[model samples]
Target: MNNGKPAPYDARVITHYGVLGLGFFPQVYYYWYKWLDGRYVGTAARTVVKKLLLDQFVLTPPLLVVFYVSMSVMERKTDLFEECRNKLLPTFKTSCIFWLPAQALNFLWVPPAARVIYVGTCAFAWVNILCWIKRQDY
Candidate 1:
């Protein structure tokens, strides 16, 4: 296609799959944790929210964004909007399927240690997604 290069974003198959892969498993695990751990409540719930949205979000996005941008640059292309669009569904699903429920439990019933472990382990999946996004050629 076009001088041995694929369209800037059309063939981003790796990233697409990565998004889906990264999105599902974590939520699945988190909910499982809830069934096992019996949800957190009161102050515990508030604390979990603070950590995930504030701390984890802040910490993870830059690393992930850097990974995404670097991969684009390596491929000699960059389309931030396209990447965002491609990632939207996976991102939304990840939040809905895993995060919302896991967090509800975290805020209402689960303990802080479990919350941290859940977030930390799930982060690896996102990192793998970033790596997939980075390594794609087209």
Candidate 2:
């Protein structure tokens, strides 16, 4: 039973998920923006839509898998994918709901140089959502 309370702050967990997980995000965001800019050229509407689709369908799924698998490894779970199997769909669904608009705004309004920082800010809230979802059983 989770008791619906967040886990106590643990430095190891923070280090792994926060520091390590986020460390790579800037580069990923930079490249993602660059790729989108290079690949999709035309109307802003078309670009934003394509960016959202790639983000929601392509980037998010693998990222969720990495999150679950990494958390499982960090926790020393016996079955690495058990939590992933249970949680992946729900997490991805929630991610789509959350990220689609956020990324659209990112692609549309936010400047390229600031996209990483913008995403990091958005991630603060998204991380909380992820933590809540991770804590839930189903």
Candidate 3:
């Protein structure tokens, strides 16, 4: 909702999130977990730290870009980058706050095969946060 108004229902929005949840995110998480599992064989503490670092630095920034851009496109906005330009940093900052500890726990306890599902579970809430951020005027 924007300014306390409910967002108009759009199937594209539903499809966009559905695709992300069913296809894009699962693939990304599976590969990320696989790579982290393969690359970091140190102590669990060290591995979780490394995973969190990569998650916060490498993966999240671009993911936020994608989120904003895709949402803009799905909304049929003329300027795809406007929302991204205005909101990416703040959204990413919020995401860092949310995902850091969540991913740390994911890396620590979630096994390779279940990592995507775990992240999907987390993404349920994260998506709501993203929606809220997207609707904000900043």
Candidate 4:
């Protein structure tokens, strides 16, 4: 097993990314629209940007941290920090890849009800990917 080290693929990169994708992609569109709308008012744009930054960068990370802790607890045992560090970058890349087009479709063309289509489709695939990852042995 490659000098007894866990190779990169040994971790579930796609699943990790998919999970993060749940939050990140949705917010991108949400905030982008908010920003566009807020620009009309002087301070509103700055306020919106600050709030978005806080929500996206500061708040969500802690939420994920909590989720990680809960996941470890619920499962009875696991290295949460290690998993977070190892999977973070891959997850970021995966979100970037999947989120771009999803957002494009959701924000640009789809009506309100149709927005759920992208979420449902992507979320389902992500859930399935995570399920598959859980089934595999490291």
Best by lDDT: 2
TM-score of each: 0.38, 0.86, 0.85, 0.46
Candidates ranked, most accurate by TM-score first: 2, 3, 4, 1
- Give candidate 4's TM-score: 0.46
Query: Which stretch of 10 consecutive residues in model 3 shows the poorest summed lDDT?
Result: 17-26
Return the top candidate by TM-score. Answer: 2
Put down candidate 3 lDDT per residue, 23-82, tens digits, no spaces. Answer: 676777778778877888544787779889998999888878877787777778999999
Task: Report lDDT (CA) for all predictions.
Answer: 0.51, 0.84, 0.83, 0.50
Between candidates 3 and 4, the lDDT winner: 3
lDDT (Cα, tens digit) per residue for candidate 2, span 55-138: 889888988898899889878999999999999999998998999989888888888767778888998899889989999997
Evaluate residue 5 in candidate 2 and report its C-alpha lDDT on the 0 to 100 scale: 89
The parts of candidate 2 lying over 4 Å away from their true place are: 1-8
For model 1, residues 59-119, the per-residue Cα lDDT tens digits are 3344344444445554556575456446544554444555555555555654645764756
Ranking by lDDT: 2, 3, 1, 4
Angstrom error at residue 102, model 2 = 0.7
Off by over 4 Å in 1: 1-76, 124-138
Ten contiguous residues with the weakest lDDT in model 4 = 36-45
**Candidate 2: worst-modelled 10 consecutive residues by lDDT:** 18-27
Model 3 Cα shift for residue 27 (angstroms): 1.6
After aligning candidate 1 to the native by TM-score, how far in Å is the CA of 1 from where it should be?
24
Decide which is better by TM-score, 1 or 3.
3
lDDT for model 1 comes to 0.51
> What would the per-residue lDDT of candidate 4 be over residues 1-138, giving only the tens digit for each residue?
589876666345555545455655566545544554354223344544554454345544554455445445545566756555554445444544555555445445555444455555766675555444444443
